[model samples]
Target: METNEVFEKVKGLFVEDLGIDESKVTMDAKLEEDLEIDSLGIVEVVMAFEDEFDIEIDDEELADVSTVGQAVNLLHSKI
Candidate 1:
């Protein structure tokens, strides 16, 4: 899938599932700092991504993924 496509899905997970504000879900936004989502919330969003994309997501793969763009790039690569 294209990066933008994966981005929209990840954005939706943050906006819908995690209850994060839509405007804060930008590519450069930090998942924890900018979005104010806790670690557990991040895990839940990642799980949502795994389910939606039908792929396994290794949590360790996300250790360095602080920004939304990085997460999208990682998930896009898996797809």
Candidate 2:
């Protein structure tokens, strides 16, 4: 999938599942700090991404994914 596609999908997941404002789901938005997603929420988001993309995401891989851009990049790599 394209990077933009991954970004859009991730953004949608954050909006639908986490109830985040769609306007705040920008590439630079911080999942924890900006979006106020707790650790458990992060895990759930990761799982949702995995299911959405049909790809496995290890915990270690998620360690550095703090921003929407980072997550989209990771998803792009996995795809």
TM-scores of the models, in the order given: 0.91, 0.95
Question: Where is model 2 more than 4 Å wrong at Cα?
Answer: none
* Clash number for each model: 0, 0
Alpha-carbon local distance difference test for all models: 0.87, 0.90
Best by lDDT, which number? Answer: 2
For candidate 1, write residues 5-41 as lDDT tens digits.
8889988888888788899899999878999878777
lDDT of 2 by residue, 1-79 (tens): 7899888898889899878999999999998899999888888998899899999999999888889899899999989
- The predictions' CA RMSDs to the true structure, in order, are 1.0, 0.8
